[model samples]
Target: MRILVCGAGGQVGHEVVNRAPGFGLVALGRNRQQLDVSSPEQIAREIQEQRPGLIINAAAYTHVDNAETHAEQAYAVNRDGAANLAAAACQAGIPLLHLSTDYVFAGDARAAYRESDHTAPTGVYGASKLAGEQAIAARQPAHLILRTSWVYGVHGHNFVKTMLRLGRQRDALGVVSDQIGCPTQAGSIAGVLLELASRYARQGTLEWGLYHYSGQPSCSWYDFAGEIFRQAHELGLIERLPQLSPILTAQYPTPARRPAWSVLDCSRFEAAFGLAPRDWHADLGEVLVELSRLERRPLEAGVRRA
Candidate 1:
């Protein structure tokens, strides 16, 4: 069966295309140039022509800080674009797997947020994503909203890549320690999506609702950066490590207000799919190896697995 993956050029989308074939499925990936979700006509035409067994909507305006200024652009892609896909999926009578974010919550909760938790987004990016969730829920009956956080992968730009880049350039770096969330890997999310796609492609139905899947042992961004450098050094990717300074969120201000506590409860997803939680730190090591290979730098002996 053919599975249509939007945002094929993105981190998760790229992983989905790479992993889909392993599930005995044909993956049809459409980047922005091939499919613009904001335009319903374009979406409808592509869906009609491709006639995919399932649709995975991974497209979104993910620039958290830039969304503060480009509210319209963010909404056009995240909210309206999502609605268009949901509507088209409804017409096609197929299941839609839409990826979401943890920013949908207000970020003030003391505990991890559940799927049933009330949403109160702090920034335009979160608000737009929340609107997209609402649109998909309202338009499609067969849909799965997979909300993930702090997603990083070898295929695209993310926090891990950012830390590696900055660490190489500077002797000391400061990262926010106040905000804490689960760091997820794009490959893990892709695996779940492909599993769900394979199931839906065969059965044509599922529970159809929102779910969460993130890496285990949530930590602050500061901790995450420290772990990245440690793994890089252990992998022999770097000779010298920079001093990582933990600072308050206010020390590094952005246009968007990130969630202070955005870790998600993944029990619902685990119960339904039976997919085990992934270790982000362990996955980070594998990612470093993949990235090193991509950069044409081979790792030294005695490299540690993530």
Candidate 2:
């Protein structure tokens, strides 16, 4: 079966495009330049031309802080774009798989949030994403909205890459210790999505709805940074582990308000799909190894000396 992957340039999208073949899928990936989800006509044209069995909308306005000032653009992409895709999918008689975030919740809950939990987003980014989810649900019944958190990978700009760069430049670093969520790997997310696509291809149906899929063993940003440095240093990706300082959210203020607790309950998804979330620590190690390999390529090509 052929699957259309929007946002092919993104971390998760890149992984999906590369790994789809292994799942017996022909992936037609389109970046923002090739396919702008905000435009209904463009989406319709592409869908008509591609004639894909499944459509995965991975494109999103992901800049949290930037979304505070640029709510219009955020809504344009997150909300309107999603609605456009859902309408097009409904028209094409194809299922739509969309990627959402954990920010839909206000983060005041004492325990992990379930899918049925009330959504009260605290920022523009989250609000826009929640609107997108609602739009998808209203427009198409054959849709899957997977909400994940704290995604990182080797292919794109993310917390892991930021930490690696900062670890090399600074002797000491401060990370917010209050905010907590699962550190999901982009590859893990891509794998799960492809698995769903494969299952859909075989069964021609799915229990489509909102589901929470994230990494195992949640931790704070400080803890995540510590693990990054530890693994990177062990793999020779970094020369020294920087001193990481745990700080409050107030210490690192930004335009957008972050969730104090972003943990999600993914039991519904597991029970429905029979696929458990992968261990984040194991995923982290795999990412670090890939980063290490990328770092070595320049030296191997004689672009940088030992």
Candidate 3:
């Protein structure tokens, strides 16, 4: 079956497109020109052109700090854009699977969050994504929304990449330790999406309306960054292991507030698909290997600055 993938160049989107062929898929993105999802007309036109049996929307306005100022843009893309895409997919008589985040929770639970938990987002980004979930559910019936947390991949500007880049420049670094969440690999999430697609092509509708997915272990940002640097040091990629000083969320303030506990329970996904993601650190090694290989290529000779 032909599936259309939006947000095709993002961390998850990049992984999904590269591996989509495993599920007999045809992917499409905004191209370099940038497809604006706020416009329903553009979505309709694209749906007519691609004629995909399924639509996986990985596109989103993901700048957390920027969303505090540009909330209108975030809502337009995350909420309204999802609605537009779902409407288009429903018109085409197909299933729409969208990716969401764990930010929908208040993070006050002090433990892993289940699918049945209540949502009280503290930031514009989370609220906007939750709105997107609601919009899709309201607009269409054949939909599967997967909410994940602490997503990182080989390609995008993610937490792991930032730690490696900034960690080398500093003699020591400060990371927030109080907050906890899962460190999901983009490749694992991509694999999960493909598995869902296979089931959609087979049984057509899943039992759950929403599901949570990520790697096996969950930890704080400080631990996650520390591991990234540790692995980099092991690979001899860096000169030294920068001292990681753990701090609290209040110590490292940002415009957008993150949940103190953003961890998601993946029981629903595992039970439904019988799939479990790999360890976060194991996936980190793969990324480093890929980055190292890319560093040696002549085409990317000068691109490996960090």
Per-residue lDDT of model 3, residues 72-168, tens digit only: 9999989999999888888888889899999999999966789899999999999999999999999888899999988887888998888878877
Q: What is the lDDT of residue 108 in candidate 3?
A: 96
Q: How displaced is residue 4 in candidate 1, in Å?
A: 0.8
Would you list the C-alpha lDDT of every candidate in the order shown?
0.91, 0.95, 0.85
The 10-residue segment of model 2 with minimum total lDDT is: 297-306
**Over 4 Å off in model 3, which ranges?**
31-34, 299-306
Q: In lDDT terms, how accurate is model 2? A: 0.95
**What is the lDDT for 188 in model 1?**
89
Estimate the TM-score of every prediction: 0.96, 0.98, 0.94
Off by over 4 Å in 1: 297-306
Task: Report how far residue 98 has shifted in candidate 3, in Å.
Answer: 0.3
TM-score of 1: 0.96
Candidate that scores best on TM-score? 2
For residues 1-306, write the lDDT of model 2, one tens digit per residue: 999999999999999999999999999999999999999999999988989999998999999999999999999999999999999999999999999999999999979999999999999999999999999999999999999999999899999999998998999999999999999999999999999999999999999999999998889999999999999999987899888899999998899999999998989999999989888999999999998888888988889644
Arrange candidates, best lDDT first.
Answer: 2, 1, 3
